[model samples]
Target: MTSAIPNRIRAYLGWCPMTGAAQHPAPDQPAGAKTGDLADSGGSVTGRADRFMHLTIAVVVLSYVVAILILPFLPEVIPVHWNLQGKADGFAASIPGAFGLPVIITLVTLLFILLPKFDSRYAGFALAKDIYAIILFATTGMLLVMEVIFLLIAAGYDLPVITIIPVLIGFLFIILGSLMPYIHRNTTMGIRLPWTMKSDDIWKKTHEHGGPLFMAGGILTVIGSLVSGIWAMALMLVIIIGVTIYISVWSYRYAKTAG
Candidate 1:
């Protein structure tokens, strides 16, 4: 029978054939034998992972601090269009660098770091270590946008140059971050939907498929930058929103039956 083959294989692999249970050490084994036992247990292994998490957060916090310090010495103004048509011009003062925007971001980032220590489920939604680099990239892009806005304003340029590229890069960062959770077993940071949170299988399947779609969508958004028109921007927004909704719905349906 089909079941007999898998049972045999599981036995050969030293795993429980029926429930995928791991073989434990014998009673005769010394107490010290459990040194690496924590690594074997899913719950305990999480502690080791936290070390890396703390280190990453430290670096992120440092970057924000440096930006906050450097911002004040730079420009103090940014240009903006008064109307939707972007025809009327206006200037907005950049207060002490990003006008305390970096402070707000740093606070949010710290909150994200602390959230995982208390709530592992929320940690699942926190940015994963592997994806931390991308999140940082997004942060860097945002800084560029902020700095560029100040510089342009000081120069009296009313263009949306800083806004366009940074926003595009930020979008790519989210798309990239979202993909890692689906591609891997560990889930400590991503766009975790209610469905994905409820059923592991549906979460895995939906992410496995959704990751690539978001990546493609991100690439398209970047390309949208090349074309000079409002319609292109509108199209990009539509794609981003549409793709997000599609993945959310797909994840929900997949979870509904998986249980």
Candidate 2:
């Protein structure tokens, strides 16, 4: 039984037990083609994807470099935290405030890049490579944007944080919503709930519903920001929480009925 487990795992992973070779279609082969008849099928797609990934990494790294360069120019105290009203309420030493946030963002970008390799459900990641790439780019891009905004604020730029932040957030939600439907079931990403993880159909349906909801909420958030920043933040939070709960319950119900 102990030895049987390894074989089972290998089989599940589409690996040859004897040769320890991948049993899946080669990257050069059509999805349903015989493994032996390989061609350079996915090379162009892979190359474009790699270029995008590299571009995202470079942008994130450049953001960090900008932060480091501006560190000396920033005041000893900098606004490190904001209130619901989008007012800078918390202050910290410039060294930590300016440098720490960029460091954390760098670490987060690294984590996002490495997570797929460590995920047991990496096959799902491969299937949803486009979705994964969008997620990576969106998240890293948001961080870079935020870093630049903070740096500008530190440099005495009176940018309208209250309006800009909400607009940025709204755009982010729109991007995420647009891409959410393409994401596949994966343990390391997406709206992972017990039911959604267990049922592919549930995952698909929930994200389908979720995408539109998020888009609507994001639009409302942007409008609210113009009217009332504090209210916009509150409403955005409500929308997110409400959608999450609704999806979780919906997944559960769908799973139960299907079962």
Candidate 3:
């Protein structure tokens, strides 16, 4: 009965059951299709999804190009670090700061693109490819926002770094939270606690509970950002950390009871 639990949960979640070595698709197999016949039927859906992925890559490339074009006009030393008080405390040479960060963002975006194809649990990833794509796009957009923030500071804008950081983080949390429930259980992402990993039901339930909690926390964070000083940062951290602990404990207890 315990062993059968995962399959039941997978069924409830509308995910295909993994079949040992055959879970991974063949080199020529179309994703999420059972056979070539089904693949042909699903071709249009797959093609549309691929086009969205291509568009995301194009956006990343365009953002990088814009960053590079602005590089030469920045000051010799750029602000690279900020304190809780919103003051710049660390600096880096404009050339490396401008170029290197965008390079790193591009590499990270490439990794996100490759992850679904290369992860050990690619089969599970394929099951949730649409959600994965949305997550990837949101993360890449966040990185681009960070790049823009750096560029704005480098260009001598009097932006409120400390407040902006918290609000952006809150927005990111809200985005992730909104999508968390759709994320299938996989080793490469999501709340990967031992008990959650052991039980599919627990993973689903945890995310179901966690998703709302995260959104609430994110709201609190955004509200906190309106206040100056370390208090806002401290409150945001407490909310995030508190939710994490709550979900882990809840998942463990739920799993134990189910067992």
Candidate 1 lDDT over 1-259, as tens digits, reads 9999966654333222123213222112332333234332222223324533554455456555555665555455644333333233765565543444455556656665564465444323321332443344445446545544544444565666523643465376445634343222223555567666665566667766777677777777666655635454555667688888888887777777676
Model 1 weakest lDDT span, ten residues long: 17-26
List model 3 lDDT by residue over 11-120, tens digit each: 33332212211232332343355322222222332442454466568667867686788887799999887776677898889887787666876787788766666566
| Model 2 CA lDDT for position 89 | 92
Q: Model 3: runs farther than 4 Å from truth?
A: 1-52, 228-230
TM-scores, one per candidate: 0.58, 0.77, 0.77
lDDT per residue, candidate 2, 92-188, as tens digits? 8987888766787678778877888877665555655545655677777877788788888987988777677777788788777766665667777
Instruction: Report lDDT (Cα) of residue 190, candidate 2.
Output: 77
Evaluation by TM-score, superior candidate among 1 and 2: 2
TM-score of candidate 2 versus the correct structure, residues matched by position = 0.77
Give lDDT per model, in order.
0.50, 0.67, 0.67
Instruction: Give the least accurate 10-residue stretch of model 3, judged by summed lDDT.
Output: 15-24
lDDT for position 258 in model 1: 76
State residue 18's C-alpha deviation in candidate 1, in Å: 38
Candidate 2: segments with Cα more than 4 A from true spot: 1-45
Q: Could you arrange the candidates by lDDT from highest to lowest? A: 3, 2, 1
